[model samples]
Target: MRIWVVLAASALGLAGASRVAAQRALGKLLFFEPALSVNGKRSCASCHRPEKAFTDHRGTPRALRFAGNLRRNSPTILNAAGQTSFFHDGRASSLDAVIEAVLTSPDEFGSSYAQAAQRLGSSAEYRQLFRRAFAAPVAANTINAALVAYLRAQTATASPYDRARAGGPALPATPAAGAALFAGAGGCAGCHGGPQFRDGQRHEVAAGQWVKTPTLRNVAVTMPYRADGGAATLAAVLTDGYHRPLPPRPLTAPEVEQLTAFLEALTDTTSADHRAPAALPRMRDLPGRAVGGQY
Candidate 1:
């Protein structure tokens, strides 16, 4: 009886792992499925390219059906799993709300959750994947849940900076100097604090307008900084763009270089799966976009 009990427990654990894998796979397909968009031309991966540290590398991405452009930069989804708020404006209270806004926004997927559910349900492969993962039919809630699961799984792995802090090799001199300025005179830590490097609160940059503090985990790669993507470079982000006034003692050119080095040292790509799947779900009239998106 003891042996049987142990075997049953092991079997259950294996089954749970299998289910998680299935769900993750399904979520990946959904993430890259352009057919979910009304025009069938874009996917979530379109704006959040994996190789570019999960950013589109665009200042502001074009909107659905080419209907103008989004107002803010496409922030990296890396290490975004546990952020308190979503988007530059912090309009969405939760990730679920963020997904829903994207689904229905005319500048985004340009489709409703009901429409997406119906479209996905028509694909037998998607239906099977959904059932296997959720033990339910293809629907709005399951689709959202799968995406949330996948997004939440994208946590950050240690970087050079993190390793150094863990008693590994120290950061090189330039980055080490930058780290000092960041935590000290530069006052970057005032807002970009915590393990994720954000305060999870909005602050007034100039006057009445407020913007959410963004995570600095991969800030090196997700360039064209600020909520509006106005700052073209790291130096520019420090000197101009959207930010509160710097310390009364301005950062000198050398200090700027050091700070940039420190910011770059924060980049770590190992935590998330960046590769695009070879194909997406089999849906009629919906061909796969490029690994990310064409735009």
Candidate 2:
């Protein structure tokens, strides 16, 4: 029902690196502390709802405070720690850099390092945590670093698919079927290869498709799929294709069911404060790799 992510214990760097306990301690709190955002109301938790696999459950491309609509759909935070890079563009490299970009991005919080420093850097609890985590005073850089560390600490869920991979006992037949279909004929295992299920690359629809390919860990939440966010459910994106490749690539009814069953089986209800219904919502591809990588 619940599984925390495990880091390989490889050190990231000197101070405020990787998933070390000291950094994670502060990072966990920073993950929810809205003070870091331009608006105190929009914490990382705002979009990446802890209960909903760390993505906004709303179906459309949500707008930030005063900012215009963002380009890509909000990717999930679950199992993101294992990813090579973040976002549809694969722009940011290190987690800390990702936080810094989000902090200043016009469509996101829209705050600069100075603004974050002025706000969160002054808090007593945050200050103390900074001292403990990095042995340095709280600042915008460390603050962002701590937040990124916390995010990297949020790992993927382990389901029957995982257990089966590990030679575990009996699991649901449909999910098992779903898993096989996903990795085989469904072409899911193509981009969604590896234990974490992503090649960390981006691809648009082949001929006439819309949206980017999101991870399968928590497919139940995050409706209104697509890079443009035109569709509402996972079903819509799968059937409609969101416009990227040109026209929609409709899935056969049976294929749709199998894929849905497979993805739904990957859901984890424990991290969520409020659970997304155990219903399959919808589904993309794209290409790139870059700096300040996530996961």
Candidate 3:
């Protein structure tokens, strides 16, 4: 009788937890909303455009409106959820931390939590959504939770490589050789390995680069190779190993060919799924607290 009661209670707790999670969709909706930008125009999509493999469309080292040398090239959102930390500096630990940090970044959203929050709370739409998603509505913590859920939702659909190895086309000779070279001499797979192609580990590659080592998942579409735009093409990035103002790697010309082939294979090559998102959220600012809900 005691065991049965305990099991029933456990199931009830899980059911409540799921309901709370469902209410969290508000945060994800806000992520792509341009209203979050200080200019009332630049959304997360401004830098991490979904259509372009979730990166800056222009592929500029520094964004058009940003200050000189935008910290690092805006990274791809491809498989970012799998990343251990956010940014080339590995500064943020989770999606919420990064979202809040960027929302107040003078270079990015440049808005305060109180100001943004009030903007959100004032809206009937935001209020109702928050109430539905939260135990109540318009709380700072609740807002943050919503945004975190939104970011975590940004997932990449399976690519050709996913299909190929899962029982379709065999890796062509060049890419096969490249894969071996990557796991072997070229050491391409040293940092980029496994299905998603990134260990989510930062390496001291000690090359003229410093980044959290982005994934090769969609290398074909996410270009302007290198965080600082040191390499213009994948081939240059692979063989020359993306440069720094200082120096580059020791990769040779033949190595570039093999590596490029491997990277090219990382592209989906046939998926048209990068369409606009469904149900664009209504974004108004959030209210209460200062520093734009600094997390």
Please name the candidate that would achieve the greatest TM-score relative to the true structure. Answer: 1
lDDT score for residue 15 of model 2 = 39
Give TM-scores for every candidate, taking all chains together and pairing residue i with residue i: 0.91, 0.75, 0.76
Best by lDDT: 1
Candidate scoring better on TM-score of 1 and 2 = 1
Winner on TM-score between 2 and 3 is 3
The local distance difference test score of model 3 is 0.62
Candidate 2: worst 10 consecutive residues by lDDT? Answer: 281-290
> Model 3 over residues 97-179: C-alpha lDDT tens digits?
77778778887777766766776777788787766665466755666666655555556645655667788787888877777
**lDDT tens digits, residue span 1-295, model 1:** 1332243234336568786777777888888887778877888998888888888788898887777889989999888877778999788887778888998888899898788888888888888898787777877777777787678778775889999999999999999999999999889998999899999999887678789999999899898888888788888888773432666577788988999999999988886798889976776655454534455
Local accuracy by lDDT, each model = 0.81, 0.58, 0.62
**Over the stretch 254-282, how does candidate 2's per-residue lDDT look in tens digits?**
76676677777776656533432231111
How accurate locally is residue 255 in candidate 3, as Cα lDDT from 0 to 100? 62
User: Residue 144 of candidate 2: its Cα lDDT?
Assistant: 57
Off by over 4 Å in 2: 1-19, 66-68, 206-212, 242-251, 271-295
RMSD in order of candidates:
5.7, 10.5, 7.2
Off by over 4 Å in 1: 1-14, 241-244, 285-294
